[model samples]
Target: MKKVAILQSNYIPWKGYFDMIAAVDEFILYDDMQYTRRDWRNRNQIKTPQGGQWLTVPVKAKGKFDQSIRQTEIDGDEWRDLHWKALSLNYRRARYFSEVVEFIEPLYQNSYRTISELNRAFIEALCVYLEITTKISNSWDYQLIEGKTERLSNLCQQAGATQYISGPSAKDYIDPNIFSDAGIALTWFNYEGYPEYPQLWGDFSHGVSILDLLFNCGKDSPNYMRFVKK
Candidate 1:
């Protein structure tokens, strides 16, 4: 039976995002939603003199804009230079810093900036690099059967999935009985087992963005996800 997971598209998210993708048979980028400001979808952290500052990509705001993951814009291409410089300065001493930094530098400069596009492409690139066999698809292509709960379950059934795993956010309020009503077993993903790297500031810090992992660990990142705890 196939396993499926759905998550909001984010900009170059952490190892956990890839972890979920790597662990599942099918992964979907849920981009059919409101575009939030100052959210993970819009910006992320990078090492800065101000102690891990957030670098935001500029976006045009409008009323209830239901922007797809492919449409967002990267407001400041110049910022990419600042980011690359900062990472180089701070992580030059890291074990695999040079290689990882070299590998991602072109991506930072040449790739498109919309959060959705970046994430979708990043996951695709990383998955191939890591040799993951899981198949991925965009949610916009299917007719999601309606009834938030039934919508997901029915869609999974349509895709030949027997199990559905959701983010921990589902643990608090998602109605499990709804899945039962649709004949799909449900579970949740908890982000744990963050790996330790040469954190410039302290012994360990969580949530510095995936760039932090790459700058410090390089190719070791794919295996680091194996440490995730339940």
Candidate 2:
């Protein structure tokens, strides 16, 4: 049976996010929704000298219409510089520092100005680095990517998916009958059971970006991901 997972494209999300994608046959990049400021698209956890700090992509809100992920512009580039500088200083003494530096250099150079593009870059790069082979599709390219839950149900059925996975929060509002009527089985991505890797600062970080694990553990991070059992 074909399985699928739908998620708003986020910036280099933590390990469990990728695990959910890897668990299914088709992973949907659900990026057509209204963009909110100060959200996961712009802010994520990263290791720092002090501890796990939130690295955010500053956007010019301009009090405009709820911006599109494709429209949100990267404001001051200072946050990018500061984050890189901090990571450089803190991880310079790390064992896998060289590998981390090489991997992240391209990200700093690109300096993505829009949320959708930035999210795409992060997800695609992570998939490549992690060797994930699941077919990824952007929701905007296909119809049924819209605000209502009915549309989402149709999208799942149209994709020829027998199973659909979503974040745990989805259960609160999305009527189960929608998927049932469409003959799509629904499951929740329980990310509550992920394992901790070799975190840099000797603390448990549950929600940081995946780059943190990659940087500290190098190629061994994949081993930790497997520790998350059903």
Q: Using TM-score as the measure, which candidate wins?
A: 2
Per-residue lDDT over 1-230 for candidate 2, one digit per residue giving the tens place of the 0 to 100 score:
99888788887688888898888888888776777866887778877657777777777778866866666777866777777886677677766778867767677777666777777887887777777878889887677644567877877887899988888988888888878988899888777766666666766777888877787777777787843322
lDDT of 1 by residue, 1-230 (tens): 67898877776677677778877888888776567777888667766445777766566555536765456666656766776676677777777777765556666676565767766776676666556768888777678765676677776877778789898876765678877876778878878765566556654666777777776667776656653322
CA lDDT of each prediction against the hidden true structure: 0.71, 0.77
Error of 2 at 107 (Å): 2.0
lDDT of 1: 0.71
TM-score of each: 0.85, 0.90
RMSD of 1: 3.0
lDDT of 2 at 72: 73
